[model samples]
Target chain A: MELASSNYIETIGFIAAFLTTAAFLPQVFKTWKTKDVSGLSFSMLLMFFVGVFLWLVYGYYKESPSMIMANTITLGSAFLLIYFKITYRKK
Target chain B: MELASSNYIETIGFIAAFLTTAAFLPQVFKTWKTKDVSGLSFSMLLMFFVGVFLWLVYGYYKESPSMIMANTITLGSAFLLIYFKITYRKK
Candidate 1:
């Protein structure tokens, strides 16, 4: 009973983190198709990327399976955002 | 040595998670002030909010402090996004 309850909790966290991290997909796809990051804020993307890197480090240190798993996806997504920022950034 | 290594790893993950999770603050602040989620995608936010809830549940079940902490912040930020979405959604 206890183990099942514990597993449920972990599963829920994974699902939540996974969904949000994956949420960037549409934006990334849009940006890729449109090649327009004019609507996207460079500062925010920059900060987000940095933050993901920190999370990756944190996850590594903490040895958290879910955190690492979620952040890995986040880092990849954020990287795409960075690419879009650089590719489409306005002068 | 092993303990220190483990500790360092966890700390890095925490820092990373903390920074990235907080990265949404500026956007949240901006959206709150400007009431603009026009550029933000609705489906994405919906997915994100749902995901965070799952993560919260996961964290609760697993009893992981850092995951819980990070997800809590994420949930709040995502909530703000939801509010902005409803407030500024197009007619």
Candidate 2:
């Protein structure tokens, strides 16, 4: 790809990264507020958390800013969900 | 980064991508079987679907097989979630 086109694609990737990763915030907030995680699948959260961590490592290796930033934020959200899954389940 | 190191990182990225994307399967299966979407957020699904679509485009541009494969699977899962959210909610 041409340099200019490559830059454009990177821009698109960044936007996509932001949207997908940030999409987790509402779930975290809702669970935090309602303390309701009855609907969440624990296996999914656990698996996703591990996946995000590896993605962070991959981001560092690849030196992609969007991947790094997105995965960091996503890791936070995934962690919150896991926490909610553990804590809210007891209640 | 050295080419060998970059290749290793991409391998890691593919593994992460597979785990994260495949993580959605359980939710989709559960929802399909039980049709329970009460815990799912519509906005999140919508946002994520769009994000995944863009990621697909990004994958094509960047020539990342992992991104393409992962986003394609993720997009399907996201779409199913959205469909379940719509169809199962009425009952």
Candidate 3:
């Protein structure tokens, strides 16, 4: 029973991780394609980058495979957005 | 020894939670202040909302206080952003 319950929780975590991490892709694609960053908040991207980085560290220390996987992908996406925000800003 | 290490992990989680949740504020503020939806991706906001909502459910099932708190706040913010995107798009 306990094992089954834990498995259920892991499934939920995995789905949650997948959704949240994949959520950033559209923004990345839109920003990349449009190169219109007027609406993007620099501070938000910076803070999110730092926060996701911390989450990555937290996941590592917690030994959570899902958290680690989610945050790693999220960290990369956040980095890409940050780069987009800067690189496209002057154009 | 284990307790101390666990506490340290908790501290990291707490900070990560605070940062990730708080990171949405500037975007909210910028959107509210400028009423700019051009740079905001509707698809991204929608996906983020669903993802955060799922994270909330996962947090509840996992009994993770930090996860619950962070996702709750993020969910609210994501919802607000979506609202802004829809409401301001026609303007």
Candidate 4:
């Protein structure tokens, strides 16, 4: 019973991780394709990046595979958005 | 010794929760103020909202206070962003 419950929790974690991590892709793609960053907030992206990085660290300490994996991908996506925000900025 | 170590982990979790949850404020503020949905992606917001909501459920199952608190705040912010995206859409 305990094993089955634990498995259920892991499944939830996996799905949650997948959804949250994959969620950033569309923004990254839209930003990349449109190169329109007028609506993107620089401070939000910077703070999000830092926060995700810290989540990665926390996941490591907690030995949570899902958190580590999700945050790693999220960190990369956030970083790319930041880059695009800067690179595509209209001068 | 173990208690000290556990406290350290809790501290990290708290800070991580705070940063990740609070990080959404700037974007919310910017979008509300500028009414610019040009750079925002609808799919991303939708996906993120669902994902964050799932994370909240997972946190509930896991009984993690930090995760619950963080996701609750983030979910609200994500929802606001989505509302702004729809409300501010250029017709």
Candidate with maximal TM-score: 2
Report backbone clashes per prediction. 19, 0, 0, 0
Best candidate, DockQ: 2
Give all candidates' CA lDDT scores.
0.73, 0.83, 0.81, 0.82
lDDT of 4 by residue, A1-91 (tens): 2433766876777788998888878878877998988767788788789888887887777666778889999998999999999898988
How high is the DockQ of candidate 1? 0.61
Q: Tell me the lDDT of model 2 at A42.
A: 91
**For model 2, what fraction of the real interface contacts is kept?**
0.76
On TM-score, the stronger of 2 and 4 is 2
DockQ of each: 0.61, 0.67, 0.58, 0.54
Model 4 DockQ, alpha carbons vs. true complex: 0.54
User: What are the candidates' C-alpha RMSDs?
Assistant: 3.0, 2.1, 2.9, 3.0
**Residue-wise C-alpha lDDT for candidate 3, range A16-68, written one tens digit per residue:** 88888887778788888989887678887888889898878877776567788
Residue A13 error, candidate 4, Å: 1.3
Q: Which docking band does candidate 2 fall into?
A: medium
* Over 4 Å off, model 3: A1-4, A89-91, B1-4
Task: Name the runs in model 1 displaced over 4 angstroms.
Answer: A1-10, A61-64, B1-10
lDDT of 2 at B64: 68
Q: What TM-score against the true fold does each predicted structure earn?
A: 0.79, 0.88, 0.83, 0.82
Every candidate's fraction of true contacts kept comes to 0.86, 0.76, 0.72, 0.65
Position A45, candidate 2: lDDT = 89
